[model samples]
Target chain A: EAGVAQSPRYKIIEKRQSVAFWCNPISGHATLYWYQQILGQGPKLLIQFQNNGVVDDSQLPKDRFSAERLKGVDSTLKIQPAKLEDSAVYLCASSLGQRVFTDTQYFGPGTRLTVL
Target chain B: GQQVMQIPQYQHVQEGEDFTTYCNSSTTLSNIQWYKQRPGGHPVFLIQLVKSGEVKKQKRLTFQFGEAKKNSSLHITATQTTDVGTYFCAGADTNAGKSTFGDGTTLTVKP
Candidate 1:
């Protein structure tokens, strides 16, 4: 089976520019997550979706960042008026979405964004 | 808020040497999961520990969870060059309904 897929493996933009990324999780997976990983650091969760509903997004910067999983299988993360700190790799992962929360996540290759 | 910390930000060892990384959480974790990320690659899940004091082994790697479920450790025996990568521990808090990841320990195996 194919793994999670992401578009535009890499992107470069100037500070204050807007950017968007797309993700397509594996078939049959019901839970999806978006993470931001800065160089040399672990991934930080930005948002999570259980099917079409938002499960958690407390860490997301609502003022400039937003994500949505409209149909429950694909997702999009956007950053408006980006900052230099926003230059990082965006990763998307998915799991079986068990009610009890015990599932191994599968990750995509991720999109590396560079903001000048 | 829950915070996960990893020790020895980085490690470099000759092949056949042993290596260990520690993970500690400010609050008790419902479960802890380990992941490995190669340079320029995304993280891939390696294992998960759900029960307190649980110990699991895979080949030359051994994973241990603290009895209090607030800490965990990963040990690599006789490391090989293939083991070079960043290892991260993620602690899940059911009450918070989220998982927090440690900064990660980058391992370099000199062949």
Candidate 2:
């Protein structure tokens, strides 16, 4: 059983530039999530997907951030016109999509984005 | 909006000392999960508590869910250098799908 995998362990971009991050979740997992973890803060849920359909994205910045899980196995999160404030770690997590009692999320090594 | 708060953002102790971190939620939680993230590493699931006043132990680590189901605590006994990391508590709402995580408590052990 392989763990969740993410690409580009680290990234650096200038303000107003665009950046994208990719994630491949664990096999057979049905729930995928993207979270933003600012330094010294907890990871904030940006979006959640269940089988290629979005379950929740209320916290996502519609104006600048977007994410998609086209085939339900992999996901990509993009930020256009990135701002310096967007510098944070992007963490991708996957779960079995069970009830809260049994749903334990496994996280991937996050992509640390540094916007200058 | 729901909020989970953790106290004592940071703790430093000797290798033989014990340490504890507390998590409190603004609303009742149906279940709570704990994760540990070492420096420069991703969060790994530690444990989950569902029933009220449930207690579970793993080696030297102990987790407890409050009787009110709105608070939780993680206690580590005789901490070692390997115990250094940030511990986070996430509370799952009645909806069963949504969860909110606390800022986390970072523990540092000095040998």
Which residue pairs overlap in candidate 2's backbone? none
- Over the stretch A19-96, how does candidate 1's per-residue lDDT look in tens digits? 999999999999999999999889999999999999899999999999999878899999998999999999999998
Please report the TM-score between candidate 1 and the true structure. 0.98
lDDT measured at residue A28 in model 1 versus the true structure, 0 to 100 = 93
RMSD of each: 0.8, 1.1
Output the lDDT of residue A4, model 1.
96
The lDDT for every candidate, in the order shown, is 0.94, 0.95
Single out the weakest 10-residue window by summed lDDT for candidate 2 chain B. Answer: B92-101
The sequence of per-residue lDDT tens digits that candidate 2 reaches over residues B1-111 is: 789999989999999999999999998999999999999999999999999999999999999999999999999999999999999999988754569999999999999
Give the per-residue lDDT of model 1 (tens digit) for B13-72: 999999999999999999999999998888999999999999999999999999999999
* lDDT for residue A41 in candidate 1, whole number 0-100: 88
Off by over 4 Å in 2: B95-97
Please give each candidate's TM-score.
0.98, 0.98
What TM-score does model 1 score on chain A?
A: 0.97
